[model samples]
Target: MKKLRKMFVLMGTVTLMVNFCSFNILAEDGIKQVSEVQTINPRSGNVYYKYKIINGKKYKRLWSADKNAWVDPYWTLA
Candidate 1:
């Protein structure tokens, strides 16, 4: 009976640890700082810099190093 109880306790502890670790990983994944714009796009994995047109349109853009072209702006300075 004592051995069985110990085994159950160990199993419960292992389950709890797994749940805690998974929760922490999910929590971390939810907290991404998109405002911290890097020189590269995280999704496309391309380097970019902030750019914009100063004409009547005044449209913003990003110069992608990999694509070698201007792309629609989706980044914000943080």
Candidate 2:
């Protein structure tokens, strides 16, 4: 009766909160930013810069450089 109804409401609230938290975590895990220099080789060129991986897709992080840094162009894709 009243006690059973209260328990069900509490359970529903807990479930909703858990779902919201999990969704937020999943979103956060998909993409992230890095500050340190890492070797990157894309079809465009090779250079060292911070990079990020989002949803398993890689993207380059830009940095200023005067000289071209040598890197194996194949290491990134192959």
lDDT of residue 75 for candidate 1: 41
Candidate 1, superposed: residue stretches over 4 Å from native: 32-78
Top candidate on lDDT is 1
**Per-residue accuracy of model 2 over 9-69 as CA lDDT, tens digit each:** 9999999999999999999888878699889766554445656676787756444343454
Runs of candidate 2 exceeding 4 Å displacement:
32-78
List model 1 lDDT by residue over 1-78, tens digit each.
999999999999999999999999999878966666558646774755664555434444577777787675464432
Query: TM-score of every model?
Result: 0.40, 0.40
What are the clashing pairs of model 1?
none
Write down the worst ten-residue block by lDDT for model 1: 51-60
lDDT (C-alpha) at residue 44 in model 2: 57
lDDT of 1 at 25: 91
Tell me the lDDT of candidate 1. 0.72
Backbone clash numbers for all candidates listed: 0, 0
Candidate 2 structure, TM-score to reference: 0.40
